[model samples]
Target: MAAVRDSSFERQAPEADAEELARRHLVQPWPYAGSIGSEARGLIGSGDGIYVTDGEGRRLIDGPAGMWCVNAGHRREELAGVMYEQAMRLSYNTPWYTMNEPSAVLAERIAAHAPGDLSHVFFTTGGSSAVESALRFMQFYNNVRGWPEKKLLLSRGGAYHGSTYLSASLNGRPRDRDWMDVADGLVVKLSSPDPFRRPEGMTVEAFADQLVDEFAETVARIGADKIGAFVGEPVQASGGVIVPPPGYLPRIREICRDNDILYVSDEVVTGFGRLGEIFASQDVFGIDPDIITFAKGVTSGYFPLGGMLVSERLLADLRRSNHPDAMYAHGLTYTSHPVGCAVALANLDLLEGGILDHARAVAPYFQERLKTLEELPLVGEVRGVGLMACVECVADRESNDPLKLDYEVGKRIDAHCHSLGLLVRPLIHMCVMSPPLIISRSQIDDMVAILREGISRTMDDLATEGVWQG
Candidate 1:
């Protein structure tokens, strides 16, 4: 009977059992290879504005803006038409020597919106490649232009740059590096700006000082001559929504400048109005990075196009030194992918047109709604800006001790919200929210209401199970 049931299950397939086996057995588990862990997770068939419809017909709100990429909502018809037209017109092109019109247009618009003299644009296939491109350029800039001995890159302890060999090495979180089991020897990690888990009474200002001193000491230990660049996500996304101190970025920028190292800002999550600014660094921190890598919102995750906005310094060095014979030796095969570029251009137009204004106007209201969660017994901290926010859970108020043994608290909250049709993600000890820029007050209220219910239900479940006697 068991063998017969197994045979029937195996016979069922969407395309075919062979195709299902191909994904489940042969493939490296799609984008995140280890997420599903020896099997497939949930399958999504389609998504509307702020909700995703799964293969099983379950509708869930997209809480993390599609992994913090889709600034615009899903199922955008205009973007769809643009992609279709772009595919029909010019499908592919070599952006190296022969540039295409879509790429040129997108570049011009991006440069204009990007902060400061971040004027030159270099294309990559996605965020990982974009970050990798920036890191490699840092090395190349040091070797070709000056300071070949400077090859070490410094990043915060909880940064999530990307997943490529070089980029992931730059990430500071233990989770991202957990299974990897080794550092690539070119990166350095320092204290993050998070005060939640740091030393007691540590003011945000003190945290900034600590970060600078930590970097300075690391530079001294490595002998600054071996350091090429100091890279960071200005608003620390995957590192538990860690926001820098009031003067954090400026202080870090100063430290990097003092040591004669390039400063690279990984704006994959903070760029394109996520922080209510085109670029979070220049707008909020008053710092000028040598290079800026951006993705996600560049195309709203519509077609996987990302790029770095290079400064005049690097561009000039590349132009003067990179002769016809010189390799310059970088670039993905899909660099400036034509169809992707067109979709990105359309995405940008929507962002600048009205979506950005909406995000800015409603951000404070959203912040207010999030702050309302502080009344919940489980919520220890609610911190965020613009459209990105987080609710940290704790068992105690003073120590901020997390309910780590069982995600029952966080899981209950997640499941309750999921059951209510609101999607939420539990990262370590927090519930992170990064809704699309197009979200309305009503949608925001609905999400917050579900969150309130989720917290209450989680507490009730915990109390019922003898985990929370209070």
Candidate 2:
């Protein structure tokens, strides 16, 4: 006998109709001014493991892993079950006056895994809020300490913190601030630590020295007394997976410590086993930050949850401050949502069960396989740490001029890959690949194979159209 379909389920509209409805009503993120309110992205029907079925029933590998989350993969029964159970037991609770058990338990677990004296957690709704909270806390801490003038934030080029007003002001990508407005007076920019983009003939070590020198010089020129915090991602994710030079992060941490500036590690993409560790600041980079902001992978994208771990030293200082009545005046309605925390706890169990170790075991292979793509003429460089990598296409490899290449190269490659059964996250002239941590070796091979062919086809198309010669 065949399995029976549930008749009680509500009927759904056709895929094309759904897409049309979205085009008429939805306003997607990162939209252009011309198409801001009328854009319909490709519709995804469902997902299982590292694969998602598209609207037309094509099974494509989730290369970007749902915006660098979904560490445990898709259709996770454990995560889904816990969300249902928690919602049924206690769906919603006001965190302003009350408390929840799961949030407390999750905080304790996270603190145990955190580095240094980071023993406190402040939960938020997502990554942007987590970053916003950290920055606000920095300001509040300074104010309570009677250093109101120390309000400037230091951010490097290629950095991406969040979308909130204060946090978005710290973004340094060229296009991020072109047409948008931010609190410009609050931020000071620094050079990006991209080794591949270093000055011609500069050694990676020398480039590292220049970056550190620039930071020290900037602090000296601007005076550390006026600076509040320096926020950075462990690995620049959206800026094309720019893994900084050796000793770069630790040296920066030391400078922050010496100057009394808060070092905010925006581990929104690197935390929760993206780099084969619970947190990469201390374990991988040998630095203890004043605060660590995290999101994306915390709950494996099973739910919207993000937070930060503040150092015990900072809290102790705040407690010992003269103003005992001053409030932080920061929080969200879903500060400690029980259902989200429950899903996070279950996701944590899944990671510790073996997925993290699996990522560690296969990271070397992942990097090595991706590096092979550099042999392609259109490929300029492929760089990343752990499971995250970027494939940068360039028109002239000798000069490494990505600007000379067609800006739509990444999108073209993505379109071809989508047809060949792989979804890619195109970032201008680069394509980012960060498959689920649970992806197998065979799946990695399949992903790389499809990417290789897609890129080759893109090259062929460009050549035929007289865009660029191979």
Candidate 3:
């Protein structure tokens, strides 16, 4: 493992002038329209293992795992090679009338790992398309079943579904929909299962029961025949990594079944070894979703690909029911792209080889290490499962009073962590960590120590500004 100089891929020392070109060209997501040049993170040059080096050659531990998709880590030569080989042989074949080998094989492999009778797959370009396809399939299934009135989609508050119009409408996060025009009557919102934000004097178990009751009551009020599907993220990743209580998912599944509603599990951020499993719905939560949407880690971020696993029973009913010759009539140009599927197949080999087991073994240690940060005065709560975690900062520790929006506590912590050799996800006042699943125990220790120091620095800054009394 000794470092060796390589002439083939020599680094071009980054010039400070690069910012000028970026400012005039690049359009970043979720930022002030005109601030990309001044506010964007500097150019990332390269990555290896669990670390990424920026243009200035600052090698930092990738705590957010490249937006929680690089489960196997960066610079995976096997995945890269697969994409290259597939491109060389056959890159694109319109999936409308024609088909490809890699696509069929990848679908079979995915169905084998999915829960229950989920034996079919519908490919998409990414997480947003996966979600959009699942919703459309639900509508199609109900329409073919003579329940065309069932068009309502139920979603929970604080859920992050996707960016497409239909999928984005299902997103219940306030900030996600504040300025955008969401499909008004298409979605019904429910409260999030955030224990930290639960009503006062309510026990966790009671809160769980209350949530299920509310769901049942809502179904009764809205009439089951009018509901199409209920979509949810098992862990609510982008909503500050909010983990629901035990038994919550199963209960929701039961309610969906009773009401003849399709249960859609959005596993875009939780699948493919991130939660110590191939897919968390069945293995970890003990529930079988009618349709499970997945993306991101399918190819470990090496390719753009995602899809939905459909239950055989549902497809069978649709095939046998009315409108038997009707077409679902929905597909993307890149549907079942040969190159993406080939890369995904190779990525699966790495996960099954040993990376999944490594993640399972190291998860407990990761969770325990993060919990220690709760002792800091600025940290109000530290919660997570597996490799994903969140540290919420507040001004009043006892009452959990969150800081003002302008404070940008999480961004401050992220800035310090970046300087100290780590990069964590910043969500307003909370910092999230979901490191590459292959990160070692020693490297995890380093990550946590840097986060601790980052928070310490932020606390000092806040004290100087007199915004928080520690």
* Candidate lDDT values, in order: 0.81, 0.93, 0.90
Best by lDDT: 2
- Tens-place lDDT per residue, model 2, 6-68, is 354357667998888878998999899999878888999889999999989999999999999
lDDT of 1 by residue, 1-470 (tens): 01111124444455344446655675443335554434454556679998888666788878888889888899887787788888877889776678789988888888886666789898998888999999888877777765677898888787888888899898887767767744568877778778677688887667667877887788889887898888888888877788777887887788788878888998989998898777888877788888899988888888988899988866777678745344558988789889999998888888888988899999999989999999887788998888999998888877888776455466668778888877787785678899888889999999899889988888888788787654
Off by over 4 Å in 3: 1-17, 34-40
Per-prediction TM-score to the true structure, in the order listed: 0.91, 0.98, 0.96
Model 1: which ten-residue window has the lowest total lDDT?
A: 1-10
- Model 1 earns a TM-score of 0.91
Off by over 4 Å in 1: 1-23, 26-38, 320-325, 407-409
lDDT, candidate 3, equals 0.90
Clashes of 1: 0
